[model samples]
Each structure stands twice: as C-alpha cells, then as structure tokens.
Target: MAFKRVSLIVAVAENGVIGKDNDLIWYLPRDLKYFKDTTAGHTVIMGRKNWDSIPLKYRPLKGRDNVVITRDQSFQADGAIVVHSLNEALEIAKKAGDEEPFIIGGGQIYKIALEQNLIDRMHITRVHEEFDGNTFFPQFDENKWKLVSKEDHAPDHRHEYSFSFCIWDKIDDSQ
Candidate 1:
C-alpha cells in the first residue's frame, strides 16, 4: 500500500538465470500463457529494456495497462504510459485506482523496484532447468519477505520442463 502495489513476475531457471542478452531463458508456451492469464487485465510497470523486449503482438498486452519507465524522452509506445522514473510510474498507477501494477522486469528495473520497496509480492515461476545467462534475479531477502503459497506443476507436453509457481508477500516486523 506504499503508493500502488507492485508485483514482480519472473521465470528463473535452476541456475538463477533470468535472461540471456535481453531475451527470456526458455521458449515454453505454457509460461507465456501463465503470464498472459495473470496479467491480461492489469497495469504493468517496467523499464526500457523490458519494454523493448516485448514483441509487437504482445506489446501492450491486450486488455491491460502498460506503463514503461525510461530516461529517454522519445521512448513511447501507444497505450503505454511512459515515464522518467519509478515515482512517475507510481503516479501513473495511481490513476488506475489502486490496482497492483505488475513489475514485469529486465534486471536493472527489477533491482530498482526491489530496492525502493515497491514490489509487494512476487509471482515467480521457477523452471526446473539451467541456462547461460546475461542477467540474473537479485538474491531474495527472506527477512523482507515470506513465501505465502506455492504450486508445483508437471511439464505440459508443449513445455517439456517442470515448474513451480510461488507467491511471496512482504513480511511484517510487527509480529
């Protein structure tokens, strides 16, 4: 509830690989469907790298809001509210009526959001595999978060790789 809620969605391999040269670690269709289903009608916040990495067909993510952050004034996408900083992103999210803005990431952007206390929950799908990576997820701090739920899933015939969906919520020190 600090500003608007932010949730991070990521698929990391067993070896902690999040991305390889600005692309995803794997090409599993199931993961894509999971992403589309969860975020289909939500506001999404991301940095320039994440925005550029989005394919044209999935650019604005049908039926959802897209907010992109960048220092470049020319960084604009139709239907995506572009901003210069995280605070601006929050302001844009404010207009969306207190809905959680999904923090679909690229390494640096996720780092910034985590450091800023913007991420409220993490919707991570851990792929049971490893890959060569150019970018990796930041080490999660258990002191700041707690795993709330998880669902282990078998690989669909199309995906060929098993995965676990996890949800982590912020930890309260008041307890």
Candidate 2:
C-alpha cells in the first residue's frame, strides 16, 4: 500500500485571480490541454457550487471520477461522490489509490485545502495578465514552498495567450 496526498492543478493570472461568476477568468487552449492531459485518469474534487457552475455536458469529467465537496447534508449529483469535508475527501482519495487526486476548483476548495495542509503538489499556470475576478486564491508565505520546475509556453495560433507553467512542492518544516 502507498500513501495518499492532495494535489492541486490550476491556472491563474499573475494577479492571483482564479474565477469570475463561477467561471474561469481566462481561456488558453494550451493550458486547458495541459490541465486535461495531466488530470485525465485521476479523481477530481471540487465544491458543489463549482460543480454546478460547470455546464451540464461537462459536469462529470470524462475518464475521471468527480468528487463534489459540500457542507450541506443532502448534497448529491448524478455521477459525483459528495463529501462534507477535506478529511473525508482525503479518505476517499486514499481508497482510490496512492497517486494524488487533482483538487480542481474555484476559491473555497483551495482555501480549505491550504488550511488543512492537504495539498502536497501544485501545477499552476501563471497567465501573464489580469482581469476582474470574483474569486481569488489564498496567499501563503513563499518560504513554505519551493518551485521545482517552470515551462514558458509561447502564444500559439489557437490561443493568443502567454503563460508559464510552474510546479511546486511543500517544504517540510520538521525536516
């Protein structure tokens, strides 16, 4: 048996904006493809509102199990596993397998996971611009994390957007 850890995969603007009106703040085909390819076979956890925000056709992600995190006692979706807290989400993730599941989300899920130390890895896209956004990712002390890799994606014909992909891991203070 192996240990389970929480991982988040997200793309945001340089200004830390994540979403607006329950939808993504920006669109870049390369970034979207990176997200889909990286998370294809993993489980994905998100808050109920985020689930609802996705279109009906895209609600249940293809080739990946969808786990909806909700505080309501009666929350359920057609093909989603509903969990009340991050603990329960992690428990279910462990049963799924050792490989960390993707914590795909809006703002609330990121906030809670950051608080519980549930996040082990982050695959982030720093889009080189900013816009008005309703949701924001929580800010953390940089001393607690170290960047492992970065890739600069040139603006493509399909998407006139420039972004940098970055991966980071949490530093163990006890070590």
Candidate 3:
C-alpha cells in the first residue's frame, strides 16, 4: 500500500525543547485536547520512550491506532503495536490506510523521521515561552516547508503560556 502523507505532531517551546527527563515540561490541557482531537481517528507513531512517557492510566490513547517503535525486539506495549523501525511503523500505518499517520515523538524519533524526509506535514503547538530541557526537537530546513495555517491562543485557565497551533506543509520541489 502507498501512503500519501506522513505528518509530525509536537509541542515545542520557544527554545526548541520538547521534553525533559522523558516527560513533557508543561501541562497545557488545551494542547492535550487539540492533540486528542486531531489524532483521534488516525494512526499515531512514537518511539518507545515517548510511549513510556504517557501517564499509564490514559495510555494507548483511545480511538486511534497506536504504533510504538523500538529497537528492542522483546519490547511489548499493551494495547499498542510494537515495531522495530520507523519504516515498519510507516508500513503499518500505510496498510491501515491512514494517509496522514502522525509521527508523535521523542527527540530521537523526530530526528530520524526528519532526516529520512518521512514527514510531509507538521502540526506544531508553539509555546511562547522558552524552557530549559534536555530533550529538544530537531531542527529542520525552513526552506523545505511552508506555513499553511496558524491559530494563536492566549493563556487560559488551563494553560500557563500563550501558544499557536501552526500547520506546515512540505513544499514540493517538483512544483
């Protein structure tokens, strides 16, 4: 099966940090809701660490096909499919007919997906504040992507910082 689109979904701080100590640095309920709504009926692929970081109680997120990528052959995640590589995960998503499978990640998985040019779009929740963290989202070539849409939101009761929901599409070089 051929897949038409592979996208990345992430919340990044102003300083490019995405997580710290294997967990998210912020608790933005709005962002969480946005994530759940956007990926509800699709396939979500993440690295093992990212999968592990999810609070145990709400894991294997309902209403979506979950694929966990890991190098460890013995790794098993209840209620989720475990694969050996990004390619394998992609194949599963493709077979599932999810044209826009979301690569929801840890730093390393994001870096690999970006480097492999496996991503066709990005759903970014851009937090307006800088954060100190050990895990950072990988830098990509801005020239290769174009902003498609953006919605800025002010800080609310459930959020501490203002943020923007930005969608970017990879520019087709053949165009």
Question: What TM-score does prediction 3 earn?
Answer: 0.97
Candidate numbers, best lDDT first, in rank order: 3, 2, 1
lDDT of 1 by residue, 1-175 (tens): 3444578899988887899888876777877888889877777888888888888887877877888899999877777889999878877777776477788887788888888877888998889988899888888787889999988888777778889888899886787
Error of 2 at 11 (Å): 1.0
Residue 29 displacement (Å), model 3: 1.1
Candidate 3 residue spans exceeding 4 A from truth = none
Candidate no. 1 TM-score: 0.91
What digit string (tens of lDDT, one per residue) describes model 3 on residues 14-75?
99999999988998998999999998889999999999999899889899999999999999
lDDT per prediction?
0.82, 0.84, 0.93
TM-scores of the candidates in the order shown:
0.91, 0.93, 0.97
Of the candidates numbered 2 and 3, which has the greater lDDT value?
A: 3
Clashing pairs in 1: none
Error of 2 at 123 (Å): 0.7
Error of 2 at 92 (Å): 1.0
Q: Could you give the C-alpha RMSD of every candidate to the true structure, in order shown?
A: 1.9, 1.4, 0.9
Off by over 4 Å in 2: 2-4
- Candidate 2, residue 148: how far the Cα is off, in Å: 0.6
